[model samples]
Structure formats: C-alpha cells, structure tokens
Target: MSSLFTPLTLGSITIPNRIGMSALTRNRSTGTVPNEIMLKYYVQRAKGGAGLIGLNGPNVLGFGIKFRSKAGGKLPTLSMKLEVKFMLSFGIVSLTLIPVFLRPIIMLAAGVPVYAPSAIAAQGGRFRLLPGEPGYVTPTEIADPTPLIAQFKQAAINAKEAGFDGVEFHGANGYLVHQFLDSTSNHRTDQWGGSPENRARFALETLKELIAVWGPDVSLKLSPAGGYNDMGMPLQDTIDTFGYLLREVDNMGLSYVALVRFDEEDDGPRGTAHDVVETFRPFLTKTALFVNSSVTPAEGEELVKSGKAAGVFMGMNWLTHPDVARRIKEGKELDNAPDFKSFYGRGRC
Candidate 1:
C-alpha cells in the first residue's frame, strides 16, 4: 500500500490517510459569510476521502483591511458575525456527515497600506499591483502589534467554540506573519526586528496566544522559500530565521507544520533554498510536517515513505479533482489541467 493511503497522527488528532487538502481561497463566499455553495464544496471533498480539509481566506481575520481579488475588485474583510457563521456551517457539516478533520487557516490582514514589521512595498510587476495603483500601498510599520495579537487570540477562541478540529495560522506566503519573519520585509529597529530571534517574536507571541486557547490543536503554515508577495532574504538569513523558528515550533509541540516548497516556475525573486522541506526538515524533529506546492500523489507517497513528511497537502489537485484522495488510492489519473480563467470568482465551480 502507498504511504499516502496510510493513517497519520498529529498530536491528539488522527487522520485516516496522509493525503490532506491544502487551503485554497475559492472566493465562493457571499460577502464575508460562507453560503450553501461553500458548504457543499467542502462536504464533497470530505465525502470524497480527504483525511484533512483546510479552509482558507474567509476564515482569516482581515483587521478591517480590504483585500483585492485577482481581477482588482475589493474583497470583503471578515467580521465576527461571518466568522461565526463560517465556523458553525463547516463545523456542523463535519460533525454530522464527514469524519474528516476540518482545519481553518486563519490569516492576518493582507491588503491596502499593509501592516508589517517595517514599511516596505512589495516588488511590482506581473500579478502584483504596481505603485500608485488602487491596491498598492507601502506597508504601515506597526508601532505596536498588541492589538493585532489580540485579534488572533479572539479568532482562536471563536474557532474553538465553533468546534473546529484545529486552526492553522497563515504564517506563510508573505502575509503579515511571513512579512515579520522575512528580513527583507521586516527592517524594523525595535524589539521585533534586526536579529532572527526578534523577527520571530511576533509569530511566536501570536502562536502562544492561539495555543493558550486550543493547546496542541493549533498548527502553522510557513513558506520559508516562497518568493510570492515579493519576499526573500539572503540565503543564510533565510536559513537562520526559519531554522530558529522551526526549532521553537517543534518545542511548542504543536499538532503539525505545513511547509510550501519553492516554485521553480515562478519568475519572481526566488528564495535561497530550492528544496525548502529538505533544508529545514532537521529543525522539525518532533512536530509532524506536511509539504505543499504542486506536489503529486506519487511524490507525496515517496515523501511519507521516506519519513520526510507526515502527509501531503494538495491545493490545485484538490480544487480540480474533488475525489483526489480516492483517485490516488484507486490508482486513477488526476485531472491535471486546471481552468486558470475560472480559478477565482463568486460562483460555484
């Protein structure tokens, strides 16, 4: 049997298989609230045999910052009302029908006048909004991150009350948390910048708050080698920063950590490490590690079999093929072709 079909345990939760669904922002919500379409989408995936289903975006706390869609339209920020509705809807569905573990990827704001450890503008061109554009604004250096940390704590409390299996912090893909971790985006002189320890302070503090609410049920998503959102530091800096962060996370004894691998196809500024998982795997001695980014079932199986990853998280594959896990188990081919044109919209796929 393929290792991908084998069960894996993370802290107290046990997934039936090693093929988990990575969080993909489908934008199917009505305003900030998730509707029937979103519910059906997750239910189908769970019923199709995903061991774990990760929900993204609408579950994120926007901190009143408006997000822009791929077509340059303003996306609604998440409100407590919508958050509760989202959690209840998915939570109830998971409890009743699907035995799959449902984890929402909670993110900090990612929009206009972006908040960061320092006031740096993302590099422009090709999928990124240029300077002076409607959505482009240099980040506002956060004088105090206390209020923001409180928002994360409250978000965790809501998720726990709503009965989610766990919550994954969106500390990846150059969002606010990632911005703080990356030296290029975090050039502050305060206690939250300069050295790698100071840089990791924000993420650690926020994760501590979440842990206080949910204990080991909390997980984190990281992209140490991701160049998306114009984020990349020098090679050694990347190693030192994430290496230190991973050691700390391992000590916390969290459920798991998901790492996004470097994209060879991306034309943007690439991070130092080409194989992100391999580079940082040693630091994560105790916590279960999941790898994402264009990974295939065969490769995922290899990773699990080789003890490199506890599971594999698929994004596009899960989105395109609802029964992706079953197909992998049954040795069926996946629908590799994804409709890029219809990737994002406020409608059913």
Candidate 2:
C-alpha cells in the first residue's frame, strides 16, 4: 500500500510526496500571466513539501512561439524527467498551457465541438462573459491563438529549463480550449469545427508544441467526461474522443493523464472520482493517473490504495494547509476548508 507521502513519478519528474497543489485560479496573474503572488503561492506549497506544484489558472497560447515538441521519439521518461540545473522545483506532472475547450452542455446544444481562441459570446446569453451579452464573435477577432500558443510553449520550456518538473496542460474549466471543445460555444464549420477530430485538432496542436519544448513529461487536465460547463458529449463519443487522444498522445511519450470526471460541484462522496477513473482505465496503459476535485487526505489514500489513480491534487485545500503533507504523513488531521479571502485577490500569499 503506497502511502500518500510516497514518492511517485510522472513523466520525468518525481514528486517529493503525493500531495500536489492542483492548479486553481487565483486572481494573481494578469493577461493570463503568472505574477509574484502566484510564484509565492507555489513556493509556499513547495516549502510545505507538497509532491508537485502546478501553475494555478489561465493557459496563455496566443503570446507564445510554437515548437515541434513531439519529435523526441515518444519522449523518454527519465527518473528526473523535467528537472533542470537551477530553478523552481516541480513534481512528475507540471500543469501548464490553457486549452481552448468545449463545454459538454454547449456541445450538446450546438451539436458539435465548440472552439474559441478567446472568451467570445458565440452561442448566446449564458455564453457571454458579462451579463446579458449576445452572440459569438468571429474566431479570428475573438482569438488569435497563433501568438498565445507560442507564449504558452515558451512558458512551459522556461519552467522546465528553470529546473522545475514537467508541465500540465490546463484543458479543463471554461477557459479558451474548453470553449472550443464544447459545441454550444463553437458554431464554426471550418476544419477546426463540426467533427470531434476537428475540435480536438487545436488541442493536439498545442500538445505537440508543448512536447517540443518540455518533451513528453506532460499531463493534461481534461473533462472529456466532465459534466461541468455543460459538457454534452454522448458516452460513446466522449469515449471515442479520449480514445483517439490516448492512442495519439500516449504513444508520443506521455508521462500520464489527469481527468476531471465531473464538475467540481459533483465531487465529494458521490463516487465521481472513482467512476471517472473507471472510465479512463480501459483506455490507458501504465501512465500515471491523477484525480483532482476536492480531494481529502483520507480520500486520496483510498484512491491510491484502490488503484483508481496514481496521485492526488489538492486545490484550495493545499493553499490553506501548507503543512498538509506533514499532517498526512504524521497521521494528523487536516483543515477541510481554507480562508477563502486569502486564497484569492493578489498580494503576499
């Protein structure tokens, strides 16, 4: 039985412990950038000895330079995969890159995979960022990812080159990638729209770029079966799309995969984590498995022991409990809830 404190490797990085600070959106970064506040937050978790520290919130692709990352021959999984000389330390999985997504609900409504380069009002009222906003904008005017993807890749490379572990692609949440993956938000009929493969094309492109810089020690946070953001793909298609990604990506030297089975709301005691893991197991090999959504130390223990996932990601929990790693190891109790106010709103930690 592997303890929560046991070390696990994802791609090239080996976490000090299994307690990871899963990425959470803190209003610290501007223009989808990581600022000093964000840096301090991660440092705090690292000092706490959390296994891994993933960047919280926003994947910027438009301001980056693109690279062909998958050519490293299925990228090798080194004992210290992405660790470098002098830099911020990270674990097996390093979450980066904001994927343009397609909400299940939005996809169901539009009958296709929604694609967005930015948060544009494509479908209707609920689609708009602000209240009562209308219709979607042109993909070009709304989002020119050519630039952002480049920036995203550079960011990942910087993290890795800086001596941190691998990077995690932020594919979940209603971010840019999420908007596109969901049909409700994306109504385009171009090569990047209509079909599932086409919808997945952009993501594939982003993945390839990240691999070019960070190699295969990468992980993606996907909601293929994610119910939040109104994901509406049929069981089969959801399975099919993920199958395609697994086949295409895993072979390219993927370190592991992290799936968000349900909306954050559906987590907790509902067995959402277990159920989602079951859904993914059929398609994956020995790749590291991770589940992030309101994870408790006890819950994480059960998950690892049950073989549901290889690692656990603590979101707001890790923020409040810097000593969470210590508590779990010492058999001490953890703070279930955190000081919400301090978690967000820039400045000092």
Candidate 3:
C-alpha cells in the first residue's frame, strides 16, 4: 500500500492520510467574506479525501484586520458589535483600542520611524489586483509590533471560529512574515532586526500567539530561498534563520513546519526543496515536517518512508484532481491540466 494512505499525527490532531491539500488562492471571494464558490471548492476537496486543507492570507502586515484573498478564503465578517463582544469574552480590552494600545513596539519608541525590518519596497508589475481587491504596497517599518501581534492573535481567533482543522501561517513567498525574516528586507538595528536570531524574533512571537489560541496544531509555512517581492536573503543567512526558526518551533511543540521546496536549479531556497528539508530535518527533535511544491506522489511516499517527512502536500495539482489522493493510491491517471487562465478567475467564460 502507498505510504501516502497511512495515518499520521501532527501535534494534537491525527489525520487519516498522509496526503493533504496545500493552500491555493481561488479568487472567488466576494469582498472579505468567503462566498458560496469557495465553500463548494473546499468541500469538494474534503469529500474527495483531503486529510487537511490550508487557506491563505490575513497577512499580518495589514495588521491581520486587512484581508488578502490571494490563496485563502476571506476572513468571515463579524459585525462590530459581535467583534467587540468576542474580545470582551476573551478578557481582552475593547476592539477599538487594539490599534492604539497594540501598535508595534518599535513604532512607539522615540526617534524611530514606522518601518519594516528593512525599508525595502515590494516590486510591482507581478500581478494586477482585481477590482475591489486591495493593491499590494511596500510595508512601513514597525516600531510597535504589538499591534501586528494582536492582529495575528485575532487571525487565530478567526481561524478557530472558521472551523478549520488547522491553520498554516503564510510566512513564505515574500509576504509580511517573510519580510521580517529576509536580511535585505529586514534592515532594522533593534531587537527585531540584525543577526539570524534577531530576525527570527517576529516569526517566533507570532507562533507563540498562534499556539496560545489555536493550540499546538499550528503549522508555519516557509520558503527561505524565496526571491518573490524582491526578497532574497544571503544563502547562509537563510540557512541560519530557518535553522534557528525550526528549533524554536520544535521547542514550542507545534504540530509541524511546512516547507515550500524548489528544484535543484531553482533559486527559492539555495538548493532544491528536498535539500532544504534535509538541511533542517535533523534539528526537528519533536516537530513533524511537511514537504510540498512539485512533489510527485512516489517521491512523497519515499520522503515519508525514509522518515524525512511526515507527509506531502500538493497545491496546483489538486485544483484539477480533487481525487488526487485516491488516484495516487490506485496509480490511476490524473485529470486534465488546469488552465492557467482559470487560476486568477480571469479570461474565463
């Protein structure tokens, strides 16, 4: 039998199969609320036999209150009255003061302008935002990280209320989380910047908040070698930051760490995703590791059997093959290829 079909446990949650779904954004949201289309899309994957599914965005740069529908459902909209009540129930102060009191720690200090780890801006002309879709802007450097931290905590609350089995913090692909980790991007002199350990601080703190609310089952997705958003850290820095980040995560007793691997010649992580996994797999004393990105089923099974990874995830393939797990188990052929035009919900009938 395929090892992909074997049961596995990630932190407190046990999944029936080793094959799960990766977060892929389907631009089907209406405003910041998930519409009926996304509901059907995920339901189909679950019924087709996905053990788990990760939705994207709620980028912390936007203070967690800002919604980005790049690869996940819109955070369910709760009315202001309900939001305030929810905060009160948790013993938190009124929602209105969240920004005022929870502002980034650095931003509140004297002589510090609000900025990111570095003052670098995100590159443009990559992809156009849809109508009503918020445009991507360069993040301001932060003096006060507390507000962003609170936003992340709120995102955790939103996720729990959304009834997901787990949530993967989108720290990869030049998003806000990755911005803090990249040296070229995070050029601050304070505690949140400089050195591998300092750069990893934001990611670690965010993990703590997530684990506090979501339990230990939270997964952090990372792409250390990623060059998106003009993000490309020195190779050794990438290695050191991720190595330290994994150890911190392992100590936190989190469910797992998901890696976005690339090919041998790919520039995302110095080497291929496989090499990245091999590099950091040893430091993970207690944490499960999940590998994804262009991984074939046979290769995934090998990674599991070899004990390098607990499971494998497929993102793009699952779009056309909802029954991908079953097909891999039976060695059946996959469905037709996904149309590139259909990915953005553009140029389609």
Model 3 residue-pair collision total: 26
lDDT of 3: 0.63
TM-score of each: 0.82, 0.69, 0.78
Q: Output the worst ten-in-a-row residue range by lDDT, candidate 3.
A: 84-93
lDDT of each: 0.69, 0.54, 0.63
Stretches of candidate 2 above 4 Å error? 28-40, 57-151, 161-163, 264-274, 346-349
In model 2, the Cα lDDT at residue 162 comes to 37
State how far residue 159 of model 1 sits from its true place (Å). 0.9
Ten contiguous residues with the weakest lDDT in model 2: 89-98
Encode model 1's per-residue lDDT on 25-142: one tens digit a residue: 6776644355557666776777678887776654455311222222121111121212211111111110011111112223323332335677666665322222232323465678
Using alpha carbons, what is the TM-score of model 3?
0.78
Error at 315, model 2, angstroms: 0.5
lDDT of 3 by residue, 1-349 (tens): 3677887877666777888778765555543245567656765676567766665522222222223243243333321211100110011111111122223321234433334555555543222334443324444566666787787778777556544455577777666677777787778888988888888888889888988987876778887656654567666777888889888888888778888775443344433233678778887889888898878888888999998999987887788887777687778876668887777656431
The global Cα lDDT (0 to 1) of model 2 is 0.54
In terms of TM-score, the best-performing candidate is 1
TM-score pick, better of 1 and 3 = 1
Off by over 4 Å in 1: 62-113, 125-135, 346-349
